[model samples]
Target: MARILAEISRTFGEYLLLPNLTDERCTPGNIDLSAPLVRHRVGELAPIRVATPLVSAIMGAVSSVELAIALAQAGGISFIHQNQPISEQAGMVAAVKRHKAGFRHNDVNIKPSATLDEADTLFKRTGSDVIVVTDDGNPSGTFLGLITTQDFNFIRHRRDEVVDSRMRTARELVTGAEGMSLAEANSLLWDSRQDVLPVVSADGRVTALVHRRDEALHHKFSNETVDAAKRFRVGAGVNTHDYLERIPALVEAGADVLCLDSSDGYSVWQQNVLAFVRKEYGDAVRIGAGNVVDGRGFRFLADAGADFVKVGIGGGSICITRDQKGIGRGQASALAEVVAERDAYAEETGMYVPLCSDGGIIHDSHMAIALAFGADFLMLGRYFARFDESPTNKVKLAGQVVKEYWGEGSSRARNVARYGQGKDLAFEEGVDGYVPYAGSLYDNVTVTLAKLRSTMISCGAISLRQFHDTARLVQVSQQTFVQNSEEVQRNERPTVA
Candidate 1:
């Protein structure tokens, strides 16, 4: 069809598309693929949405908090990462909130002066489930600790006994987060060889006490995005209207963000899905539309009731939209253009719709690039492929660790036997393959996000929004990218388990 259109352009058009596509950044009819633009808001007080705005990279891994905490701590979300059980996913979500909001109470701190009766009073009045023993739970204050009536016996030589004499210090207490990553915190507790660590705030007030067993369970965040400082949208991908029929199920399963996944997501089929969602679901759920390279497509989705617009066409790691179909634009260039347009629409409508740079991000640098290029959020693929919480197991191929990854738009994807068809295809039994096991999700997030934060600090930017606009991009020659990869291979000496 593109060839036929190309021939027609050749016959009568002074400006042609077929050859213009060779420009790689060119579009037909002076579309100025780069003409679209977006402006984001960032400031000292801008709410740092560090719990929402995340999407599980919908692979074989069951969406779970194993990945969610990492995303949530950065104001991103994670899907349950699996189709095993809804109850299990709910548990993860609950756990994520616990992890992020670690230790929200200071008055709950068990001061040495408090008697057994006082502990019961605090618990009764505040409905607090736990209490920590401390002189005054101040970080700079002398270390004091926590205790309950059950602990009263050990220190109870007399009712007048000062709680500090036998009370547990914050160091002896357990720690946790509501939705943030807890690996480092967990490690701290483990290294201390303590059974519990009282999770406290910067002010040194104790909130909750985590036991070792708490770390063994899963964690999760909401699967949807809301606004600045908040991003976690979870929804099943709808390829066809027939798939539209399955929206409610996903919504019931706590899916608040819908992704219309397809290389040609702007197709009439997709438009219909967007339109229906806008008219029917209203604000109850967030609709994400795209895989688009231009603003016109972005506008179409926003107007159609999409709460968020997904950008980039055929930039997926396993995607061959540029090769198989011989069509595509550089992901960076494509996102920059569409984001510009979307920003304009948001301004005119007084409605801000966020964009996710949907693909082509490989390393931490690329992720930073995507954010700078106008993506409100970054959608990663291959990066999450080797994670422990990923739905599938790992395998060795030619002595290299790899996992099975595929395009959502592939023909085989069209008739998936596991996840059913259309919207029913929210999940498949999963591709039965193994990924080269990479130790822990914590390790990946620790290394990757730390690098991102350091880059932000170097750029003299504090928040993610600032990081997006001020980041400097230096394009690499193919040689540079290759050499960089080699250097990485040499320096990244992970101890193989």
Candidate 2:
């Protein structure tokens, strides 16, 4: 016989937080959003810590290399999706690892002897107006010169004309020595009145380009996530079926961490995958697992050696698993249950395994509520899919610009391994959809984080730990929720003219 739990499943919308007495020290400026990303001793710092408690979901539409770079720069992380071929996914991981702060690598390069048409092709392919001409046209070749769109026009120059005829000769360009600090490079750029300063090695090879605009944008990323080598930190998603082949490739490509991408993760297959990772890499690799919804599921993954346990099943914005299979707990209920287990486990073993609330985050308030309930971080799909940094194409629909969003279980993604429903996806567990387009990630995240900081301030908490220790919440009835909305609508109504 199936057992029934006594507690009713409750979502984030059913709860409200009560404000605590504001202390003089509890200000938005004092609030620190840093949180652990992996398991660690009770008193020791986690090996990996995200500057912010936000991570983009491991979905095809959300976790592109571009989005991963932007989020890491913004103090968060994005797990590159694993739905593609192993080599392709590994390449994405490599691209993020190769990204340097305030420096552009030689993706924009051409041979000095190349024709103008060839140079133009390279410029358009890289989306860079300024092209660095090298002896051999490779990133490591000897520096030759630089060319820009302003140097030549179709009417003035023939397509077959060699690039050397129009490029600014190396003698004319101001070059910085290798290992020049960003501050020093910026100083030279402004003082010399140059649009860019190419950093060169002793062998006279152009290593990287320091752009004037990149310098201005660099200052905004004080909390960017980075590895020991100073490269931006990024995560990759792996699957049980491809673990043998995918894990090594991603690790070789410099993925800082990996997650087992799945819709439901409380199975022996997951344990087998964990065992394999442990046997192969030991503690040298950090991997997270799950979409578990309760204490039992959380304990299962934790015992199997997951560095972090993701909580929530069928709670994503695009998910239809609950409707298709009726097999999911409400996100709030699931998170609360797993948190209780995490606390108990910590008490028993003195090892605190971080809990990631994976879905059902509709409002900024839900983020705060999840934190108060002991979620170490939040994983979002729809929230990130609406941003400009996401990989989805922007299309006009119903007079509004929107971006595509879909679930891994949807026919569109056909991620059978994530669902573990056999050789193929037996039925649709997710849906394809669109979200209203939001502007740049920097702008949207700034406002969202501001609201989160304000919420913490109002609760008189200056840190995530303090917020968890002192927070209070009350369940709201449907009538009260309706009344609250009505009051807001009334307040928003305009006064009579």
lDDT of each: 0.52, 0.89
Candidate 2: misplaced stretches above 4 Å? Answer: 108-173, 193-196, 202-204, 211-218, 487-497
Which run of 10 residues does model 1 get worst, by summed lDDT?
Answer: 11-20
Against the true structure, candidate 2 reaches a TM-score of: 0.89
Clashes of each: 70, 0
User: Who wins the lDDT comparison?
Assistant: 2
Structural similarity to truth (TM-score) of each candidate: 0.57, 0.89
Give the per-residue lDDT of model 1 (tens digit) for 1-497. Answer: 33342221110011111110123222222111111112224212222222322355544343444455444433355544323233454444444444433222233555677665666666555434456665564433433665655566524456566666556655555555433345666776687676666655555544445544445422322222233323233334444544444565556655545566555556666678777766777665665666677787888777766656777666666566565556666776677678788768866876667786777765566665566566776666666667665545456789987756544444434434222344444432222333455655556765665665555555555555554555555544557546645744356768989
Q: Any runs in candidate 1 off by more than 4 Å, and if so which?
A: 1-54, 61-75, 79-235, 409-436, 477-497
- Which lDDT tens digits does candidate 2 get at residues 334-425? 99889999999999999999999998899888998999888999999999999878989889999999999999999999998888888888
